[model samples]
Target: MRGVVYFIIVMLVASSLGCISEKIEKPDKKRIHGPKTKKIEEKRQVDSTRKRLGVVSGKWEQLNGMDGGDMHFIYSTRSGVLFVSHGFGGVWRSKNGGESWEIIKQEDFTDVYFYDMEEIGEVLYAGSNKGLWYSLDEGESWTKLKTGFPEIDDGTYHLVSLAKYKDELFFTAVLDKKYRNGRPGDGRLFVLKRDKTILELEAPANKEITVSAKYPYLFISSPYSGLFFSTDGKRWRKILDKKTTNVFVDGKYNLYVGTIGDWWYIGRKIGNTWKWEQVKIPGRKNTNSIFYFLVPDPINENRLWFGCGGVSRFYSFSARGFGNSFFGVGCWNGELKDWKIHSNYATSIAFYGDEKVKTSCGEATKYALVTVGRQAVQKTMDGGLNWSNSYEGVFGDTINAINPIKSGILSGTIVVTAVSGTEIAFNNGEEWMKGIDLRLGKEVGGGKLPGYPWCAVSPERRIEGKYDLLISTGYPSPFRGDGVFGIDTSCLVRGGRNCVKKLIGGPHYEMVISEGKLYAGNMDNGIDVLDLETMEVSKIDFGSGVPLIRKFDGKLFFETYEGKYLGDGWRWSGKKGKIYFYDGRVTKTIYEEYAINFSVNNREFIALTPESLVYKPDFLSEEEIRVKLPNKKYTDMAIAWEKGIIFLSTDGEGVFYTTIDELKSGGVRLKEFNNGLLTLKIRNLVYEDGYLFAGTRGYSVWRVKPSQV
Candidate 1:
């Protein structure tokens, strides 16, 4: 057990004693888990058996980028800062004019969506679900405008348009669900006066007012009142009796009024008689209905760019949400791609495309392995550019785990776990041999054999000065690992009942090593540690459920599982699994949620969560740091500090990454590194040689190079 091998096989059955050797790594601090005075003393060194993978370096390949997320309001400031509201996510601003964008406020617009945003002078006015909000400091902060738009019966109000008239800012608070039934009265057209007082404009609510400096008259399109034109902002004239959807007046006094059912009425003045001609919209055929947009084209005079929204469909399990009405993004540029005709909403079109970050490709390692989820295990010698899976299509079930040991008696050997149990690859991945059945570790007839061939690892150990593989049952498997079955490369099973006793009553999946002893913590059983040299199983309990345990520097730190459930709130489970810390029988309540799959490196305790990567320097007195992820459901993350990069494995959206230092200090950017990922559900991630590896749930394992920074 006094070894730097990555093998963590925890078996706690009584056995004869052997000589005990130690590779003691000293600690500066230890957490006293005793009652009353429970506390973690100081920091300590990291002497982990398995070293971390990946490097801190280089440029990455190409990705479509910014392809996901729902689109909301799009605005361009006077300084040419283009911003798009990415649905549930906050505002994404493009500094160099939409060449790229970074999320400025990722948590904004969670409760509501933005309706409209326009820059007036220096302040940026935005109409949202909660009335009009003006941002004086560019988009950093926002304050609600008290322009007669008080909160209705519902908490939020629907603000549709914000316009400036006669040196005053006017906002039209339109019909919401509370007011749509004509109960909360009419929509309010309020204006912000010069003295900062909000005064109600003498105009009908629920009507969109179209203003143009080139035209003498202002047109208002109302659902009930049709089209009304005002000459002096007070005098009104009924221009058209037809229900107007959108009224647009260009610079040359040409009016293009759109109605329901894809009708566009173009009106222009010739001397005195104004001829209004109706025409069908072109280039938008085979698309869904059009919603909010009309940008006058500077390049093409006769045509206008429109936002032809997504297709509408009924909700059902078979539909899979692809038939949404707000999905399609349309353009009248005389060209259409196959994807444009599909049910995808494309907003905020920009040709200024540039990569947000550049990475430099570094040298690759000679040996690399690839394990697909239900497929073959391939290996490459020329740095992953080429792979060979000679024994493919042999296993009917999916391959789960791949553990390659380099310098042991089973050197150049790999251990694989799948639905049918463990398999071994003798020469890197050329040939694989089926090993023991997966049910060997489980109780004889307990609840049928678990299908998923979960944890499998072969730790390198020297028994009686003879180097042999003495590890099994990787830490915290799909379930309780049942027991450890030590086997050699040639299907030679080493440990039996004498090897590991039958574990019952509780799950024994999560395993760790400390003080020359292998410790296992399960959901039910309190705790059990195995002294490898003497080879004896000893159970330790604190009277409660030990859900999580980590062994560091001869001390045991554990948390009692309480009310952690899978389906709580909008989360599967949080990394905050520990409420109390324990060492031996000593216990102390830290009152912090630091980790679920916790790992400590250089005193940095990394807490991997579905939402964010929580980081702290130590158990106590360390400044807490959190790196927010763009998407939820983060499966795995790998930090390559030497090359200065950290890779994040997103569930369906592929991988994203950022620098190590930037992540620790609330990042400014985290680029998606999905160059070759086919599947969305990425389960595992690792960094080897110069490639960032992603183990997807479907398709196959993907590898990409992290360009050198």
Candidate 2:
């Protein structure tokens, strides 16, 4: 069995955790107060090392989860390790078929992505947008293999596909509108020979290349022309006039051609001259759309999985998507199981209230906005009933966060969103405006690579009676130091294009304003607190520079380090990681454990440990209902008071939500509130007007009402 399967293991860890013990007040070990009004100087140097000359660009990528984006490539090794690549820079390997998987590696460089992987003899090879990678130790580790590969002029290269043809190996290169030697870079296919370094095939360039599993046929789905076939590698044949989007050859050597409407195929060795028949997708007979990849499932010997509707401009939204999805994928197993799509890889989702929009019976309607990968921006005016990208000028390409905000009293609640890079744009409930660089003019080539850029408005302590736009260049290093920029909100409203952006360059857990003080915790070196009136910066001697300062129950709290158990690669820095409450001068250690991520809702303290989302109403109660979702790790969360639900954004697997009333009931059913989300891996989530907006890795963004789910 070597395919993606759903396995939910219900854990009753919540059963016994309610009786867990609690320790309090290690006074001397707690708070690290500031040296009164003493200021600290900058010491860390700005190091922009690797990608100085390269144009840094990244699509919607998630630094948190593993399972997302488009499933680009999947290769099963003889050793039983199945390597799969998706959107973002997600690459994972499963040893026990596709039932159990582990994160081999994630993104490390600029625009980290893998497209194809193959098991060549003993060594496994992978083709990525950046370059080629090979694993010698059964995918335990991977190393870049760039022996003779040419570096493109843009510094980045896209190796689309790779396959073995009998004894000779062939690879396909994807060009990105850049020209070289009077030829488009995307238009090249080459074969590796024993003596010769490389040999270009007779096949057309710039088109997608694919090979048959056992047959000696090579097919190219051309971006310029239609389909081109090369039987002997040296000679080629064109299937002209037949507009094909993609091609695939099954293990039975069945040639399947994908067109804009429906699919056509021809069976094995039926002679060079055969009839291509339009076939129904096993169970989905009426699905009038094209598919990308066709692969025989290893688990169900005769079954197949279709990488449906990918992110391509060829995927015409005007003609309708694969039912509200551009990057929608599906699989057909057996007669009983039938045809099904378990997930939708949504990147980021948001909502904008339209008081003007109402139902026929007359009820106010709120527009739901979602970025479905290359499908661009999709909106559902009447909730999730009908989603369409009909509206023009929305720059939804790889957006990270989509926020609906009231820019001004007259502007109303429109869209002010951030893409994967450093740019942030606003849409005044009509069309998208030109995005502004949050970097302003600072150098982002070095440690400052393109990350998930986020924007926020100062909630309180208005500087000079005016609010400032606080923007952070996504999570460059998880919960560590991220780029924070403060600009006067008035400047943006007044169209002050070249306004001065105050760049507080350093690492911090989080920066915020409370009681007229700007607290920048986890400075990497030390914690810094700035006075709003004086603009004086004083170093707070927090025990750990990695301080996650959060406000809960009218008091300020922070984390020192990680505790007991770990979910993933996060360092469990022993007993150092504990919850501490700050009382002006000193701190008090409250709950001790690995409290990396925590939140407060309705007077309850919620701590996210490796094991569970521990909740405590008060510090006095020794009882803590440590409930956890089915996921190993999760992303951000939102507490919907009206819905009385605690929504958790997962690393993968969309949102896991449960009602606060149910948590008190002890035996709770933590339901998955994902309806239209194709990708399980979620990066960010927000709940508004009974709608939950989710930001995914590859599927882009999607929204579904919790009550509807």
Judging by TM-score against the true structure, name the best candidate: 2
Clashes of each: 34, 32
Clash count for candidate 1 is 34
TM-score of each: 0.41, 0.44
Off by over 4 Å in 2: 1-467, 473-483, 490-497, 523-526, 561-576, 628-631, 688-690, 699-701
Q: How many clashing residue pairs are found in candidate 2?
A: 32
Q: With candidate 1 superimposed using the best TM-score fit, by how many Å does residue 469's alpha carbon deviate from the native? A: 6.1
Per residue, candidate 1 scores C-alpha lDDT tens digits across 461-569 of 6433332443333323344444433443333343233222332233443344445565565445567666657767788765644545543333345655544434212
